[model samples]
Target: MENEWKIDASESDVLIKSRRSLIDYMSGSKNNFKGHIAIQNNEVENASIEFSLKVNDKDSNSDLKLIDFFENDETPVIQFKSTSFQKVNKSINFLKGNLTIQNITKVVELDAEFIGYRDYNGTKNASFEIIGNINPKDFGLYYNSYSSHNGYAVGSDIKLIANLEFKNQ
Candidate 1:
């Protein structure tokens, strides 16, 4: 039997990291996201997630500039819908999904780890860590020419790490 689980937003987090140089990077996190997963026999059957594309970086100026790169006013949300899940082991799985950003959708493969289940306050909860990399240019996010000159060019790839907790529903 497949069981449905709703994400516990308060206990989940999505982190974003973008490198501007070899040693310089900006990181931010988001806790406001909605998602659900269907699991059968301890394996994920399907999953989908959606969240606004806001990066709460520590530096206000950097945050604003990053948001502009994403054209947030025009396309404000990022969405993912799983198409397949391939179990690699008891704990690791490869989740292939369609990721939509800036009105462009691309197929991406994410590394998902099943962190097991816990009974918290009489409710069954599951935890997972999903990680992936994406190129901003692929989503039509181009780096500013001024910022690219010298040694300030932002890296092409952005790293995404999601720590998700879901409650049985």
Candidate 2:
């Protein structure tokens, strides 16, 4: 049987940082996501990856502004599924996937890196980092406003970074 890996959601962290050049400027992040990855030959092998985030679970250490960023009542969940994986090296890789937001799915690419493995407590674990950028407008999460300081209320790109750990369970 092939080995399967699962994300240690309790120990892993997914932080999504978004920025806006509004009149006063705005930037924040949300940490909390569930993800999994398939491994082969000590590297990511195929497209058996999945990630999900609950809109209502977003936190920015201030007000709950993410709720309005997403239509939680209609699309409570944001999802991502891998379509393919390309290994660049032992430490670097690329994942082509689909990200679904508010029922809209768009093709996206994420840069991944294997940060090596470790023995935490009594269990073996693997660590990785994934980074990507997306245009919120592509997912129907557009915030348009003519900024007096600049051009638009928010930039077209939103950056997402996740430092994930998988337990050999």
The positional error of residue 21 in candidate 1, measured at the CA in angstroms, is 8.6
Residues 109-159, candidate 1: write the lDDT tens digits.
999887879888888898887889889889997766345545455667877
Give the per-residue lDDT digits (tens) of candidate 2, residues 72-164. 475456677878888877777898888988888989999988776898998988888878987878888755434432354555677777677
lDDT of prediction 1: 0.69
Show model 1 residue runs off by greater than 4 Å: 1-3, 20-32, 38-65, 71-75, 118-122, 145-153
What lDDT does each candidate get? Answer: 0.69, 0.65
Residue 14, model 1: lDDT of 63
Residue 66 in candidate 2, Cα distance off native in Å: 2.4
Clashing pairs in 1: none
Best by lDDT: 1
